[model samples]
Target: MKYEKALLLVLAVTMTIITELDLLPQIHRMGFYCGDPKLSHDYIGDTVTARYLLLISFFIPFLILIDKNLYQSSFSTYLLMYITFIIGYCLCISSVNFFKILFGEPRPHFFDTCKPVEALKCTPGSYVSTFTCTNSDLRRARDSTKSFPSGHSALSTFSAGFVLLYISNKASDWKRIVQVLCIAWILSCTVTRIFDHRHHWWDVLSGIVYGMGLAVITLR
Candidate 1:
């Protein structure tokens, strides 16, 4: 079991690195109409940066686990549980990145990021796929095209959902408060995605469902 878990961890790490490097298959070149209000939002910035979200997602549950098990469980047992949590997190992110590339749904701030060269020439309501971005930042331009399943939503939901399930299995008096906090975090992530013009309602919904599903599977 230890060897199997180690191998799985390695695979998850490799997949995550590949996704972060955008080394997977090319994102689908989805087209958009000229003057589409949906894609016309300005890309201000993330309310919760990716790094911040990841840190909280990891440490919050980790702290909770440690607090709950500090007196009841052995160090080795705690380590094993934390490893499983990591595995679930890695799997969730890798899968979400794959879907983002596959669907290639435009971000709400697509026009701002992409700045399609043909924006001025394309007819209204007509699809325009053949165009180049005017944005000098190549990485941001590339990311603008792959916003199907919000990674933020998926990661946030997965962490909170997983922790909630963990809390539910325990008989501690503080479990209810922790559960409420988890739910609030997930909701906050969802609201920020929309308000920040990062994802559509459907994209957030899909990611939430995806994350929740993985959370249940991980706990099982």
Candidate 2:
């Protein structure tokens, strides 16, 4: 078990490094125009940071108390479980980033990021890939092309789904209500990406699928 735990920890760390290095894949410009910049502009959601903080806060107590109680209070057991969780979380996030860069689907606010001239009009259902973005912020411009899979949805669902799975397994009574609330929260977060114009509906859907799939696999 210790060796398994160490392997998982190493795998998680490797995935984290890969994600941080941005070494997975590059975005391919599709030049797809989904909508006007005015329609795509909206208040950006801060759920990414909020979800990370929530997971850390909740998981620390959960591991120290609930998990400990459930598993003989052994530190090694707790470490193993925690490492497994980290592996799952990192894998889900890194996979999402991989797909996001691989697909290179344009965000709803592509026009704002690209700042292409209106004169180079794209007919409905057609794309104009020949234009360059006028946005000075290179990071933002690059991010605009990585909208295939919503990172917000992916991370939110992964974290929330993992918590839900833990509660389902470890909680005594009232687990059903907690599970329902978790599902609701996950759905709400997924929908917010659409309202924020950071991702399309399909992107959010794919993210949910990927995240939940990873959670289930990890817990199993």
Candidate 3:
């Protein structure tokens, strides 16, 4: 195995162990302060909203970079980056959703919208009828149900991080500056999630760590 692959395996295994042991809570507290995260899902209807446009604009160039480097670039490292991103995409989505179903932690507007708590178990009836938020929030409880790890944070992190790695290897001058800026961008994305109150700090942190860990391990 490549030495990097060996390091990747160790990192993944260590992460699994750490999370299972619930060590993060002891390490990091909540956040700056508990802010109300409830945002109107209404803006989603307006595709031109700042949130929508900002996110799309940020990701588009990153996608271009990934494409440029992925199958098109000559570097063998790029191939590994490509394969790992495809796999990480699946894993991130699946793992977040799976945990959401398992936990069913209330959404941000849970108090305002949720029906009186049921047995807190995922029964067929609960799935169909139990709790709901107003608006499309009610329409997609499944998406809101699992807030432990922020998927948006994970995705953005992965994209930025992979590109950062590519740039780190490819750039000639100001490599350190590029990487620092990328890490700052990652922090900004994670903070945005908390600022919007879409997720708790813990959730974003998980995504940050998961995104970086996977990128470093899987792509290196």
Tens-digit per-residue lDDT, 84-156, candidate 3: 5555544544454445455555445443333223423434322333433343454444344456676667755
* Rank by TM-score (best first): 1, 2, 3
Q: Alpha-carbon error at 46 in model 1, in Å?
A: 0.4
Cα-based lDDT at residue 56, candidate 2? 48
Clashing pairs in 3: 37-197
> Arrange candidates by lDDT, highest first: which order?
1, 2, 3
Q: In model 3, which range of ten residues has the least summed lDDT? A: 26-35
Task: Compare candidates 1 and 3 on TM-score and give the better one.
Answer: 1
Local distance difference test, each candidate: 0.84, 0.67, 0.50
For 1-220, candidate 1 gives per-residue lDDT tens digits of: 9999999899988888899778887657788989999999999899989988888888767646536543245767667777888899999989998988887878999999988999988888888877788999988998898788988889999999988877666676667777888898898888899999999998999889999899999867
Clashes of each: 0, 1, 1
lDDT value for model 2: 0.67
Residue 35 lDDT, candidate 3, scale 0-100: 28
Q: What lDDT tens digits, residue by residue, belong to model 2 across residues 1-220? A: 7797678768877986797577765746566543545325643644545455346423532533433444444777666666777888777767777777777777877766656564156665554655566778777777777887877777768777876766654644445555566677677678777877778889989888888888789878
Off by over 4 Å in 2: 21-27, 34-75, 117-125, 169-181
C-alpha RMSD of each candidate structure in angstroms:
1.8, 3.6, 10.4
TM-score of 2: 0.77
